[model samples]
Structures are given as structure tokens and as C-alpha cells.
Target: MNQLDQLKKYSTVVADTGNVELIKKFSTQDATTNPSLILNAIKLPKYKNLLLKSIEYAKKKNINLKETVSLASNKISVDIGTKILNFIPGRVSTEVDSRLSFNKNLCIFHAKEIIRMYEENGIKRNRILIKLASTWESIQAAKELEKENINCNLTLLFSFAQAKACAQSGVFLISPFVGRIYDWHINKYNLDSINIENDPGVKSVKKIFNFYKKYSYKTIIMAASFRNINQILELSGCDYLTISPTLLSELKSNFNKIDKKLNFTIKNKTYKNKITEEEFRFEHNEDIMATEKLSEGIRQFGYDQKKIEDIIIKNI
Candidate 1:
């Protein structure tokens, strides 16, 4: 079997895209999307008609063009999310506004709104995970949502403290970004290529995996934003992995023998290297790499979101 199939034997593989076509082709177990991916998809020629239809849909409802655009933009995301969930036979993550990353009540309200939209279209809550950032406020937001039994995916994790915080808060899942970590280290050291093993990104997930497995935390770890197939291979036994289309295609072609990189049964499990949340914040703050990357990540996604919103309004 190819490595993708083999990896599935150990961990769930998720498509990391907003493109419904790719999700259908790979048939990933779950799928993830952010503002960037959605913005990227709208540029495709095939989606032009979708934009026009959204405008028309707005007109018939006596809604202004802007409202039509807003409705259509949301519809495109959910429409594709629904498709991915269908093909994958599992959950599909749809994100809330990143600007509300710090407001727990607003996050909960928006999450409920998104869920209501999904349910209105006949999509069940069990198959949808509301994606939120890992800010302290968002963590609190997730805690509340979990009580309502609405699952969540904590994105933009960079430090172990963030991981522990999410687990302690009792979130359903967390996506530790792998590629972004590697990027930080590469740019820090001015390295050209990053190895699958010993890569900082790989190490971050390993740290979280070992911690979660050791404590038997109910919150799942799904490594995201991988830069290469090797990193994906290194994380073969994670709870789940969200991979981009290029790496998925590469993994699809490679039929290498696989071995479990990290698992729950290992002895001598505790790493005394742990630190306090304040310490983690200071450490991450001191590490120019993590700080810069975190800011860049939020900016990049926020930028795309604004761009998409602009296009929607422009047509209105």
C-alpha cells in the first residue's frame, strides 16, 4: 500500500484545503479550511459563476448586493465543507472570525451561529468542528462550546503551554502547526532544507503527542501546515494530520515502509523540560522566531479574509 494508506492504518489523514475538488479526489477523513484557503479558491476560473449566482440569490431575496455577496461567500464555504464531510466520512472544520480571537462570549455566539447555519442546511453538528484560534479567550470560548456539546479545533498553536492549556480547557481537538514551526527555525538559522526527523515542526508535534499520550488527555492532536512529505511521514501516528494537497499527492505516490514515530506506551515518559504558562509566554516571546511567525500567520489569514470580504462587497 502507498504511504497514505499505510498512514491511515495508524492516524486519520485530513485534507487541508478549501477546494472541494481536491477534497473529493483525496477522500481525506476530515478537512480543514482558513480564510487564506478560501480566498485562494475564489481566484479560480471555475468559481466565477458561483460569485454571480450569489449575487442573483441576493437579488431575489430583496437583499442588497453586499448582503448577497456576504451570504454567497458564506454559502461557498459551507457548501464545500458539506462536500468534504460527505467524501471523507468524517468531520469538516469551518472557522469563526479571527478578530474575535480574544472574546469568549462573541466566539461562542458566532460558533452557535455557524452551527445553526450548518444545521439549517441539514448538516449535523456531530460532523462539524468549529475552528478557533488558541488565544486564552478562545480557549475559554471553547470550554463553553464543549459544554453545549459543540466540538472545536484550536488552531495557531506554537508553544507547549498552549497545548496544555487547550487540553486542560477540554477542547475536542487541537491543530499544532508543523510547517510554521519549521519555517521559524529555518529562517532563524538560515537553513535551506528541513529534515522530516529532527525538524522543529516535527519535534513540536512529538512533544505535544507524547504529553497527550502520557496523560491520556481526551483532547486530540492533529498536526497541521506541513512543509513536506517527510514531515508528514514523521507524524504518521499522530491522532490526526491536516495536510496540504501537494504533500498529499506526494505521499500518495510514495510507498515506503513505515514505522510508528511516537505512541502512547513508551516508558520513562515525563519530560522535565516543561515550563509555566508565563514562562512559555516569555520563552516564546523571547524566541524572535515564534513571535514573528505568529504575528505573520494572523496577518496573512486576516489579510486574505479582508480581501475576500472586499470582493464580496465589490460585487454588491
Candidate 2:
């Protein structure tokens, strides 16, 4: 069997793209999209209809140009998410705006608005996972949303403290970014040669995985932001892997035997006591790599969102 097929035996593969057509080609069980991916997708000629459709809705409501652009910017995500649902059997993750990541109330409000937009188009809430950055506010928002029966996918996660907070908050899923973590260490140490076996990113996910299993936490660990297939292969038995189409293609073409590198079995294990909010903040602040990467990821997403809005504003 091909590596893709073999990997599927151990994990649920999720397409990490805004392009539904590419997702269809891979037969990914689920799909995830963020402001960055949606921004990139809108520039493509094929996804041009989503923009035009949003504009049409704004016009029909007699909204002004500024309002039209804002509405279109928000609606475009739902339009694409609705389209993606037609191809995949499982859930589609739609992210809340990164600008709202630090504001718990705003995050909750926008998350509800995104879900409302999806529901307006006949898609059910269960088919969607609201993506949020793993900030204290966002995790708190996720806790409230979960109480209302809304599942969330916590993204931009790096540190074990972030993972611990999410699990304690009863988050539905947490995406520990493997490639971004690896990138931070790779550049920091300026290493000439590296061992994939002892990859820092892989070890981070394994640590979280062991903690989850040892304590029997229900939050699913989906490794994201992979730089190479080796990172993905090493994390073969993770709960879910949201892989890019580029790497998916690489795995599809390579017919190699993939092994399950992670196992979740209970042993004589002990985990740290659940952390307080102050402790969570202090630990996250201390991890320079996590602090820098988390901030950078949010800024990049916010930048792409502005770019997408600029494009819509131009048409308006």
C-alpha cells in the first residue's frame, strides 16, 4: 500500500486547504481553513464566484461600499466553507478572525456569527468546528461555546502549557503545530544535521499525546503546520493530522510502508497538576519560541485578512 493509505490506517487525514477541488482529489475525511488560506483561495479565478456571491448579497441588502466589503469579507469564508462541505463527509473548520483572538466576548460573538452564516446556507452546526487561536481568552471562549454544544478547534498551539490549558478547558480539539515548532528550533540552534527521530516538534506532540492518554483527556490532538512528510510520518498515530495538499501529494506518490510511531498505552505515569490562569500565562511567556511563534502566526493571519479585505474593497 502507498504511504497515504498506510497513514490512513493510523490517523484521520484532514485536508488543510481552502481549495475544495484539491481536497476532493485527496479524499480527506475533513477540511480546515483559516483567514490565510481563505485569503489565498479568493485570489484564484476558480474561487472568484465566492467573492461575487458575497458582493451580490451585500448589494441586495442595500449596504454601502464599506459595509459591502465587510459583509463580503465575512460571508466569503462561509461561502467557501459551505462549498467545501459538499465534498467531505466529516466536519469543516472555519476560523474566527485573528484580531478577535485576545477578546473572549468578541471571539464568542464572531464564532456564533460564522456558525449562523453556515446555518443560513443549510449547513448544520455539527458539521463545523470554529477555529480559534490558543490564547487564554480563546480557550475560555471555547469552554463557553462547548457548553452550548459548539465544538472548537484550537489552532496556533505550540507549548505544552497551551495544550494543557486547552485540554482542561474541555476544548473539542487542539492542533499542536509541528513544522512551525521545528522551524523555530532549527533556526535557533543553526544545526547542520538533524535527526527526524529526535525532532523537537515530534517530541512536543508526543509529550502532549502521552499526557492526554495518561490522564484520559477527551480533547483530540491534531498535529498541524508540518514542514515535511517525515514530521507527519513520525506522528502517524495522532488523533488527526491536518496536512497540506502538497505533502499529501508527496505521500500519495511514494509507495512506502509507513509505521505507527506513537502509541497511547497507560503505564505508571504522572502529570503535572492542572495549571492556574496565572501559571499558564507565565509559562507561555517564558517559552520564547512559543511566545514568538504564537504572536507571529496571529500577525500573519491578521495581515492576510487585511489583504483579502483590500481585494474585496477594490471590487466594491
Best by lDDT: 2
The local distance difference test score of each candidate is: 0.81, 0.91
For each candidate, what TM-score against the reference? Answer: 0.88, 0.95
Candidate 1 C-alpha lDDT tens digits along 118-175: 7877999999999988877888899899998899999988877778878887899999
Error of 1 at 274 (Å): 13
Over 4 Å off in model 2, which ranges?
A: 59-68, 266-272
Candidate 2: C-alpha RMSD after superposition: 1.9
lDDT tens readout by residue for model 2, 1-316: 7899899999999999999889999999999999989988998998887798887877777878766776777789989999999999999999888988999998999888788888899999999999999999999999999998889999999999999999999999999998898888889999764589878888999999999999888899999999899989999999999999999999999997888988977654545588899999999999999999999999999998889889887776
Q: How does residue 236 of candidate 1 score in lDDT?
A: 81
The residue pairs in collision within model 2 are none
Which residue ranges in model 1 land beyond 4 Å of their true spot?
49-73, 266-287
